[model samples]
Target: MTVIAVTGHLHLTDPTVHLVRAALGRLLAGHPAAALTGVSCLAPGADALFADAVLAAGGALVAVIPSPAYRDTLDAGYTAEFDRLRHAAAEVLVLPFDTPDADAYEAANTELLRRADLLVAVWDGLPGNGRGGTAHMVAAARRAGIPVEVVWPEGAGRRPAPPA
Candidate 1:
């Protein structure tokens, strides 16, 4: 089976969300449903979109939560979707961290990379602003010899301000 992991920005515009979903769906369509396993953190933006596409394509999902309190850090609006995705995951891995912090996020990213055979990034080809960002993960994946596929569809763009 081929394992695909995702990393991307969480602040996407509405139009960009549709574009990302379509792009991810098209990519997932290239593989046999039963042979594809998607790994993600199930975060609000790209991660959630990837998980949805994986489930729609009949692929298994593996969710890697950054910390035990990761759910608490999510916006209230995303809780239901996050819970649904978590419930749908074939395997749920909660890291040893107690809280959601930068270090915890970085560790989670490392674990995702370690488990992924291929990394499907929904990045906009920009440099990451800080640690554990999509750009950082992509670079790490390349260094580890994991194949990386960037999925930034035409006209897709990030929101001007990040989600609060």
Candidate 2:
């Protein structure tokens, strides 16, 4: 079985969301569903997209929750979707963290690497705003010699940050 893990931005632009969904679906179609397992942190954007694609493709979903307070940290608008994905997960691995901080996120990413045979990065090849983001996971995958499939579709763009 091939175990694939996902790491990417959580704040993708609306257009980029569709772009990524199609790209991820195509990539996932390349594998036989019976022999595939997808791991995801199930964050708002790319991660949720990947998990949905994985399920649609008839593959197993393993959710790696960063912390106990993870759901509380997300916006209320996203909680329903998060709960749906978490419920659909074949296995849910919660990291040892009290809060959903960068440290917990990084730890979850590390757990993802330890369990995955391939790392799918929905990245734009840019530096992450902070630690425990797509770039960090990609770097870690590279260092661990795991194969990485980058899924940045043409015209994909991130959402602009709101005024401070």
Clashing pairs in 2: none
Residues 6-114, model 2: lDDT tens digits = 9998889999999999999999999999999999998999999999999999999999999988998887899999999999999999887999999999999999999
The regions of model 1 sitting more than 4 angstroms off are none
Error of 2 at 107 (Å): 0.6
Tell me the whole-model lDDT of each prediction, alpha carbons only: 0.94, 0.94
Clashes of each: 0, 0
C-alpha TM-scores of all predictions: 0.97, 0.96
For model 1, residues 1-164, the per-residue Cα lDDT tens digits are: 99999998898989999999999999999999989999999999999999999999999999999999999999899999999999999999999998988888899999999999999999999898788889999999999999999999999989865455
